[model samples]
Target: LVAIPPSLLPCWTIHTSQWSLENTIRRRPLLQLGDNSHRHLNPSTISVTTEREEEPDFADHNTRRSEPIRVDLPKPATRASTEAGGDDFMSSDQPRVVESRPSALTSNPVHEAEDEKDHGTVERPLVGDQVRDVIRLIQCRKCSRPLQEPVTLPCGRSLCKHCLPETHTRENISYPATPNRLQGFDCPYQECGRNHAVGDCGVDVILTKAVDNFKAEMEKARETITTAEVSTHVVIQRPSAGQTGTDMDDETTSRVVKGGPLVAVYTLADSGELDYNSNVTFAEVSSLGDEATAIDNRTFSKVKESVRTEMDCQVCYALFYDPLTTVCGHTFCRSCLHRVLDHSTYCPICRRGLSVSPLLYRESCPSNEHLKTIIQTFWADAVLTRGDALAAEALNRHREFDIPIFVCTLSFPMMPTFLHVFEPRYRLMIRRALEGDRTFGMVLPQRPRTANDTHFVEYGTLLRIVNAEYFADGRSLIETTGISRFRITRHGILDGYLVGKIERVDDISIAEEEDLEANETQQALERYESAATHQSEDSSTSRPAMTTPEDLSKMPTSELLSLGVSFVERMRQQSVPWLAQRMLTIYGECPNDPALFPWWFASILPAKEYEKYKLLETRSVRERLKICCGWILEWESSSWSLSDCRIF
Candidate 1:
């Protein structure tokens, strides 16, 4: 895995950029103070704020007082503007009288009604609903009003200080006061909502300053920001039905009233130099940044709306849910990303091959944490509702009983199943299984004798993946071990493979310790003694049995185990072909425990696959051993020889 620096963490970075404090901020004109002469800005470290009015109470919400708020915005100047530049927006630091008109914004709001009733506050002429619709970046996300005591959250969004304690009032989440229980809540921002808790976040000093400046600038703009937004992008309001034709004498006509359309006037052109009627005024211009650096109030609101569109996940056609960014620099919801990977090991957005991504083999997150936080901070309520729906859907899936099945080979319990997945259907199955619980079922193909059988063998093993290596061609090599055997109850087809519901097959040795039935006991003893007579006549083992077949019959399991272990030791010493070095390396040394020896012997026993299949069918350990011991006695008596057991 690549080791990214802390400052560049949560994303990849380009190390070559000169990131220094010297020339970080390239300023632009904050506001135009004159309509006669245009002055281009020269971005600088030091700024000179010319206060045109002395001791002006910018926050006097009691009346419609006129105040001139001045800010110095310096930037690189164009040749025409620099040569013809007279004084700044004013002659000196003195207020200049200009024809002013009251800006239109709705005074009626949900919070305002509550504040007036509870706090006995007077209602001033605030921004109207049409203006509020276009200006939202500087307001409180929770209450949809100007921020009071703005607090910066961990998510990098600004919130009012009063919003944190209202978690209990807003949602049904209970914040228990138990000392041991962790205190936190799910994030509310819809785009990247997750769990979060209140931390030691005081009022953000920078955001407070920005908000204070905004309030002062907002009041000042009521008297000044009426002429133009930009050269072509202008803000225009339609005339009322009773108004006369273009005898435009009234300046208050520009004001948008309640229920008026918030039209964004566009005059886009393809010419190198813009052509315009000299009648309409235009905003001061500057060079835009990478995308844009300077913007008017209208531009800011439009950018916020555009960003909302980019936050949606293409796979689901909705907002991101646990978003993860790929190494290819594209982002998708984490669940959608893995679902795409199941079909093809490539990015859905760019189709970049992800076979070499370090994220696949190990469990490290490449999630868009900062993006989630910002989204959570914006639409917390909507995100909470979405999270609840997603959780319920996930719960329903877990309650279902379907499992993918690979019908290629016979797999026994507690044994390895090595696989080279080349088929497209099985590759997709393996990828999905690895991404999920790392489990799937393995069953043997139907034999010709059971030609009527449309599906695979009923009995199979559930394998858990241990390791895997993927190739560029989409094939993968994987190593897995059998977890348990299962019996298929119902089956269906998925894609090109099989999926089934199964029940686990556990060993049934609960009755093994009890005495066998009278007739069955007699039959077992006869079988052992008859085999014992041959052991005496033509035995390969040099050692004598410590107990006879008579002692073994009373406790049938232990006696059979003794018989099997001695025969295995004799054959192992004899260097039988099936017990060769390769076989030992693959399956490991023979197990000594009676409960385990049956599976080991059945694996390497040079018998037909159908005979070996019986081991999986029987649940009792004693029955499985009888099948193994019978094979050994038969192989010993006859001059039997064969090649190694077939794995494929």
Candidate 2:
């Protein structure tokens, strides 16, 4: 028995497992070396014997020996001959192993050739007889299929052109195309872990041809086996009860016995023909890695659409952004689901009731690993398409209509708000903002007992980011200034951040100083006349006699303006409250002009939000001032305890 070396076990075992019994018989042949007992055997005269093993039990039996069939093997192909194909064919210095069954026998006696000087040298097998399967272990690790258009890397491993890391496209399709040498990708194989530029690799045409030839042989063998199996099966008629025949059968059945690992069984069709394709066996799923698990010819052909669909958000119909799976075994993008739950406490796909509180926490809804692996492996094109689409969508998003929001403290116009963005959602938000408009809204979150009640006040300020400093960990310190006030028309979440459609709110500006002065004069006269009428109605005797409109018309216009101004001054001179004074100190001083003073005071004062809400409701500057002046007077006279104060 010729013992197979342990070093050859991996290759031989893989070959045995891959091919059927018939293929094994057609491929392997028995060979024997000249025995020392033969006295005519000279050291210089090397003798080789070859035999064709046709029986399946050839390896098991060693008692029989055939007559010595002395034959000469052809020389190995020269490097110059292979290079004729192309420069891609680099001649290998390593000794090539080949197998062949000699067709012609040499009858010359060994003693006659003993005197020859070059008699001992045995010729290498011919190139045509070389078995490419010997190098099958070096096939591409990714596809586990033989390498095509092989590119030998700097790491000394050759892989299919498509399997190289440099061949992978950018995640963002909109990104400018760059050379493969600049991509800098690490090798996928763990055994030879190294990083190299794509340009550094060269095509190995010899290796590519070898792999292609091996695949061709495998395909031809499979076709032969399929044809033989189909032809061997013929329908046999059942014998009658009166007839006693060796081939007699009560029920009809068709079976074919073949001397191989797999039996060629066939089913008879109604037309008395064998169904060649029916009941075919398939190879077991190999445990190669993520690529093999998620992608195969069967699965790929089954799902003809891109694999990215499995990782897409049902609502957005895009690749998942922070994916989350529901308890109903349905998966969705986290932000899309959150926005869906905002309207109802049920899952988007299944209508099953889900608690809103837990979904609010990212930890409670982790990404699906299987889907993620599928995307990262077999969906490069899909990922790039989705990323470009998302980037374009973000760029087109309007600041007034659909701006992302930071739901925290309130920010006023012209005020600076510093933020430490650490949350992954917020980081994504900041990154997107920087890429687009670099602007977002800041609104105060409604203080609810539970996190499930995620709400934001209607009024918020738009902040334009100035500069942001990002840390290595993806955290950022952003500096921004409130650009303008906006009231939320509608609210929703994207990815993980809040987004809203807002209308701009600004202090009403006058076109001219003359028009403002005229309006102020008209307002003072009207207020004075109305106040006089109100006093007279309250107490006729105590109050001064009311003047008729005709009489007031007779009075000088200058006198009416003077009286209104005096009344406003008296109210303004009254002792300011502690809360109002603290606000003035912190927010700097209020505006000197009476027309602009009310707006400045309202923004800084520590007043009830409802009161501030009322201030925001009015368009006239005079009306807002009147409300604030009245409140100040009431606080001074009522002697109410300070404990009643509540910061808004």
Question: Evaluated with TM-score, which candidate comes out highest?
Answer: 1
Give the CA lDDT, 0 to 100, for residue 388 in model 2. Answer: 35
Candidate 2 TM-score, C-alpha based: 0.28
What is the C-alpha lDDT profile of model 1 across 1-648, one tens digit per residue?
111112222211122133232143232222221221211112131132211212212121222322211112222222211100111112343232221221121111211211132211112211223223323344566654556676654334555677654342212121121221224444455643533334313465434444455455344333232432322222232233444222254222122211112111111111101111111122213222111212233333333233344556667655565555553445666656645653355766667654222222212333444345434433232233334334444333322335788887777777766777888988888877765667789887775465455446778888877656567898766666777777876565566667765665655312111213222454455565565566754453654343332343333565567668778778888887777766665567877666688888876666776678888988666667777776665565454443432321
What residue runs in model 2 are displaced by over 4 Å at the alpha carbon?
Answer: 1-401, 447-454, 467-478, 506-586, 593-599, 615-618, 634-640, 645-648
Model 1, C-alpha of 553: deviation from truth (Å): 7.9
Error of 2 at 330 (Å): 59
Using all chains and alpha carbons, the TM-scores for the candidates as numbered come to: 0.35, 0.28
Residue pairs clashing, model 2: none
